[model samples]
Target: MSSSTATTAPPATTPTTITSPSPSSSSQQPKPKTKLKLKIRRAVAPADVAATTALINAAFRADDTTDVYLGAEHERISLATEESVLGSMTATDIAVFVGVVSKAAAVDYEGEELEHKEEEEEEIVGHFWLQKKSDTLAWLALLAVSVKGQGQGWGSQLVAHAEQVARDEWKAQRLEFDVVNTRSTLRRWYEKRGFVPTGRAKPFAYELHPDWEGVLRADLEFLYYGKDL
Candidate 1:
């Protein structure tokens, strides 16, 4: 999710992966299971700036799964930076959220081979950027999860949490955002999360700014979506 539209247009559902040993094997193996526990909180500026930037870039940069929207044609997740993240956090209209997982959960859900601080209590796994539009509406941007943290329902949880905050805390009547018109998979992901197309489209507003160095394709546009909070 992001603010690429000249200060306009802001910015997923998934299956649960919780598993347990088969009934037949439960008695013998103590019921081996894998669970994902995440802690989401408002991001602290300055301290979380760099980690947030790295996580966003790692999750959104041109890659096999994300190329349709962000690949070489769109540069990369280059728009995120310490300065920008910190700015968003400090701005009254914006709120930044970060998702974290404990070391034990990382080992059980992900693998030891993944990069993380096993010695630490928890590690950053994902983040999102939100901008309030009005008393009844808000925009979401920069939604992302670390590469190692994807496919385990983190995205879904992030979206649900965002809506709760928008509704309960901000009193937003609806939560809104946009997706690149060409990214069907991503669109479907949002659709599964209950966001529907508003039959709206607009020129893609982001260009390669000096801070986010990279090449961008021409004539891009976005499709908008909204959900009543």
Candidate 2:
């Protein structure tokens, strides 16, 4: 009797595969409403820089990250940040003019991080920056999505926004980005977004990142990527 009971309990204890609710029934469930509307604001003002930087920095860890961290502080802590990537003026003229006229060369800031100097309509949740690489070429300097807001297509929308600006506003013939060879989630993400490798390299960035925890071991191969603007 005891042996029979043990075998019966074993059979009853086996896990069952439950079927999921039907699509029509699942669709009837209440959907939670959200206040934040997902859209890319056309012009990012100077005031948006600080908030955006914090958002971008959140994508990194303390030890190792990527090329975007080069020539910058080790941590994302803004309290220790020496220079403002985002500017304090709505206009780059006053700030940029100072770079040109003062102790430092303005060209030195050509590839520097972004700074905002003026008020803006919407808070910048994510951003994509583009600069003229050539008369016909525009480089995507940065594309960062707020950590909490990622996986929601904000990054894609931002990329599309940048391409439109490059194509229509800048009238650029080509758009590109330098994925400083690192095995990163971002590297794959960019490829999924329609960018292809250009097989290029630059050796100077590693010296600036001697402490890189991520495998930025060499100045390494920068896989340049492009898509028609």
Best by lDDT: 1
- Local accuracy by lDDT, each model: 0.63, 0.43
Candidate 2, residue 81: the lDDT equals 18
Model 1 per-residue lDDT tens digits across residues 1-229: 3343343222221101101101111112121245465789999746687888787666555344332333444544454556666667766678889998875566564333444554767677778767778778988777887666555677888888999999999999999877766666677778888999999977645543333334444444677899987
Candidate 2 on 41-154: residue-level lDDT in tens?
533445455554554454342213334344334443221011233331232221110000111211122334335435423444555445555678876644555443433455
All candidates: CA RMSD (Å): 9.2, 22.9
lDDT of 2: 0.43
True-structure RMSD for candidate 2: 22.9
Model 2 bad stretches (over 4 Å): 1-37, 42-46, 62-84, 87-122, 209-221
